[model samples]
Target: MRGRFGVHGGQYVPETLMSELGQLAEAYEHYRGDPGFTTELDSLLAEYAGRPSRLWFAANLTADLGGAKVYLKREDLNHTGSHKINNVLGQCLLAKRLGKTRVIAETGAGQHGVATATAAALLGLECEIFMGLEDTERQALNVYRMELLGATVHPVTSGTQTLKDAVNETMREWTRRVADTHYVLGSVMGPHPFPTMVRDFQSVIGREARAQILEAEGELPAAVLACVGGGSNAIGIFHPFLADEGVALIGCEAAGRGIDTYETAATIATGSLGVFHGMKSYFCQDDHGQIAPVYSISAGLDYPGIGPEHAYLHDTGRATYVPVTDAEAVDAFEYLARTEGVIAAIESAHAIAHARKLVPTLDAADSVIICLSGRGDKDVAAIARYRGHTVKED
Candidate 1:
C-alpha cells in the first residue's frame, strides 16, 4: 500500500519538507508498536476525548421511522464536541515528540483548526492555523475559539478563498518553514503517512463500533453509515468493517443542493480521476480536467475531492458512496434536534439524512449504524440562514 490505493501516497511536498516527513514517518512507525504510545493515547482518550463514546441505540428515531433498527456512534459528545480530537491529539503529541515546537494546520469549517489549537494549548506548543478567508468569515465562532486557544489565524484569500486554497497556503508555509513545524492535516485525505496515520488515529471509532454492535446485537450490523468530506470519519468507521462480508459501508457525500446542481460537491458520484493536492485521486473537474468549485452548507464538506484511500476503496467496491443534499442534511439536522435531542453537524447530518432514506427501504430487522461525526454548534447560524430563520437555540 504505497500509492494510489497503494501506489499514490508518496511524499509530494517540497524538498525542504522531505526530511521532516521522513523523520515523522519513522517516529510514527516506531509509535505504531510502542506500548507507551498506545497507553498515552488511551489515557488521553479516556481523560480528554472520553473514550468508548456511547453507541446509543436510537429506539425512538428507529421506531418512529417504522421499525428499522438504528444505532448512533455518538462522536458528537467528545471533547471539542467532535471526532476531530481523536486524530489531532495523536498528531499533535507525535509532533511534540518529533521535537517540533510549532503546529500548523489548515481548516475549512474550523473544527479541526479549533481541535488542533486546543491540543497545542494543552501540550504547550505554539499553534498557528491558516483558514480560508471565506470560511473564517462563515465560521467565525470557530475562528474565535481557535484564537482563544492561542492559535494565530491567518486568512488565506487565494484560489477560491476556500478549503483547497487553505491547503495550498498551509503547504506553502510548511515547505518554506519545514523545520521546527509540523503540519497537522485534519483528515485522512493527504499524502503518504497522513492517509494511513490519520486513519490509524481515528480508527478508534470503528474499533469501538464493531464490539459495541456485536455485543449489543449478537451479530454484525447490516450497514455502517458516515459522511465523507475529506473522508476522515468515514475512513475511521469504515476501515474495521471493510473485511467484514456482511457489513456494508455506506459513505455519504455532501450533495449541496442536488447531485446535478452546479453547487454540489458530490465527488465520488460526479467526479473523475485526476490529480489534486499531491495525490492522483477522484476530483470534481471540468471538461479540461481543471478543478471545479464546490459548495455545501457545511463548509467542511465543500471540498471538490475526497481522500485517495477513499478513491481506492470505491474502486475496489469495498464501499458505496451516496450523495446527501444540503436541504436533506438540514432536515436531518433538525430531525435529530427534535427527535433525539441532538444537534448534528451538517457534515454528519448528511450521513444521518442518507440513513433516513436508507432505513425506509431496509427490512425492520436490518440494522444500520451511523457515525455522528460532530456536533452542530459551528453550523447553527448557517443552518438558520439556510432555513431563512434565526437560530433558535445553541
Candidate 2:
C-alpha cells in the first residue's frame, strides 16, 4: 500500500525526473491534510467548482431499458462540465503551495485542459496545455476555451498525434521547466504519487455517491459503473465501495470499432502488462513491446494504457472491466438524450452502453449507478456530423 497498488504502481520515469517526483510526493503528503489547504479547497469546490453533484434517478431511461432502477452520478453537471474539476482544483492548489508560478498538463478531449486552465486562472498561475493535433481539431471548442482562459495550447505532432503523444510532449516540457512549473497530471495513472494522489482527490465522488445512494435507497447498490480512460472517475467512485462485498465495481473501456480489430483502445481486453507513461501497467503493445496505436470515437478514452490501480483490480478479480464499442456508445448517447434529456459525453456513454447490457440481466429489485462523467456539448458537432446532420455551434 506504500505508493503502490499491489505490484503494479511504481515510478518508471527518467532519472532526471526522480528528484522532482520525490519532492512532489513529500509536498502532496504535507498539504493533503493541512487545515488551511483543505479549507481553501473546500470553498473552491463548493463556491466555484460545484461539489455534491446530484445523484439523479434516471427513471425514464431505466424504464425504457426495461430492467432494474438506475441512478446517475451527475458529474456532467459539475463546473467545467466534468468530474475533472475535482482533481484539477486539488493539484493546482498543490502547485501554488509548492511555490510554482506555472502549471502544465496534457489533455485529450479538452475537459482536463479547460479545468486546468480555469484553475490556473483562479490561482493566478501561468498555464500551458499539450494536446494532440488530431484532438485539437476534434475538440476545437475546448482548445479555444483554454486560450480564452489565457493558457497556451501546444498541438503535438509526434507518435500517433493523440493522447499518448500529448503525454510525451508534456513530460518533455516538465523536465525542462521543472523548477518553475508543476505538471498537473490529469488522471489516475503516471508514477507512484500521482495515481495515489489523484485517487484521493477523486475519492470524493465515491464518498458522496455512497452517502447519497444509501440515504435515497436505504441500501447499497448492486453495482457501480464508470467509463475508464485512465480510470480516474472509475477509481473515484469505486474506492468507497470496495469494502462492500455485495456491491460490484465495473469499468467500461472503449472498443473503438471492435475488440478484434487493431482500431480499438480496449486495454484490459487485449493489452499485455508493460511499462508506459511512467508506470508498469497494462498497455496496448506489440509482441516486441512497441506501443500500439489506439483509437476511439471518444477522444478521452483513446489512450493505449490504463492506470496501474485498474491493472491491480483486474488481476485480483476485485473489479470487472468490459469493452463497449463505439457503435453501442453512440446508441446509448442517443437513447439517453431522447429518453431522459441528458446529453452524455461519448466517453461516459460507454458506461451507459454497458449499463444497458447489464441492467437487463439483473432482477428488477437490483440497481446500478453510472458515473455520468461529462456533458456532451463539446461533442455535439462530431455527433451531428456522425449522424449526417448539420449543426452550428454558437
Candidate 3:
C-alpha cells in the first residue's frame, strides 16, 4: 500500500529482497531530508552532473511546423550525455551513505550503465552493470565507455536478450549479494521507493523546465513530451506539471515497426495490465500471460513495460501515451538534424516525431516542450545502419 500508485506499484520482489527494499525505503526517507545529504547532492548536481540544463527555443522548427512554438529541454547537455546521470548520482550517493561497497544496475541502451559507472568511479564504489547481449552489440561504444569508467559490464543472454532480460539478471544479482551492494535501478520502474525515489531525482528536469518556460513565455506550455521506455524521462518532466491541468503530459512509446505487428514495444498501446519486474504495470504479454518479445530501433526504448506511475497516469487520464514507429522516429531524427542543427538521440526522436504531429494541431500562440533526453552521438552508427548505410567500425 505504501508504494501503490493506485494499485500499480508494490513489493512484488522475492521475500529475501523484502527486508533490503524496506531498509532502502527507510534510508531514502531519512537522507532525502538530511541537510548534509541535500547540500552535497545539490553541489554534485551543479558541479559534476551539470544541473540546470538549458531550455532552448527551436525557432526554425517552430516556424517550419507553423503552429505551436517548440522548446527543447536540453538534458542531452548533461554530463555523460543523458538524463540518466541525475538518478545515478542520487542513488550512488545514497548507497555510500548506506555503507554499500558496490553498486549494480540494469541498462538497455547503456546510457544508465555509463552514468552509473561514472558515479561509482566518482564515489569510489565498485560497479557492475547488466546489459542485454543484443543491446551490448547495438551499443558497443557505450560498453567501452562504461569499462573506461571502471565498471564490469555483464551481457545478459536470457529472455529475449533485451532490456527485460537485463532487469531480471540485475535483480537476481542483487538478491544474491544484498549485504554490501545496492542496485541502482535505471528507470522509474521497480518496487516501492524506486519509482518514487527515481522520480524525485529526475524531477529536476520538470522543475527547471517549468521555471525556464514561464520566464521565457510567461505561461506554461500546451504540452510536455518525452519518450517513454521505462518512462523515467517522461515522469521526470511530467511530475512537476501534474498540478497544472492546462499543461498536458504526453509520452511517446516505441512502435518498433507498428503497433499492429508483434515487433513493437509500445506498451501503452498494445500491452495489458500485468505484473512484471516487481511492479504491477502495463506489459506486452501474450495469451498465456508470458511476456512477449519486444523490439525498437532505439535500444533505449526497447523495454516491454512502462513505469508503474505511468500506468496510474494513463488510467487517470492525466497523461496520454502514443506510439511512434521506427520509420517515423528515424525520419524525425534526421529532420531535427537538418532543421534545428541538433542530432537528438533516436529515443528522443520518438517524442520529436509525435511533436511534429501534435504541434501542427495547436494554435500558433501555444507552446510545447520536448525533453531531448540524450545526445545522439551513441546512436549515429546504429541510425546509419537503420537507414541502409553501412557503418564500418575501426
* lDDT value, candidate 2, whole model: 0.94
Give per-model TM-scores.
Answer: 0.97, 0.98, 0.99
Write candidate 3's Cα lDDT for 31-64 as tens digits.
9999999899999999998889999999999999
Q: In model 3, where do residues sit more than 4 Å from their true spots?
A: none
TM-score of 1: 0.97
* Between candidates 1 and 2, the lDDT winner: 2
Error of 1 at 355 (Å): 0.7
lDDT (C-alpha) at residue 298 in model 2: 93
- Model 2: pairs clashing at backbone N, Cα or C within 3 Å: none
Residues 1-394 of candidate 1: C-alpha lDDT, one tens digit per residue: 4544744445566667767777887899998788987889889988988988999999888987774699999999999988999999899889878889999999999989999999999989999999999999899888889999999999999988999889989989998887889999998876677888999999999999999999998888899999998899999999999889889899999999888888989999989988777677788999998899988888899899898888888888889999988889989999998998889888999999988888878888788999999999888898888878876434
Clashing pairs in 3: none
Count of steric clashes across candidates, in order: 7, 0, 0
- In model 1, the Cα lDDT at residue 295 comes to 88
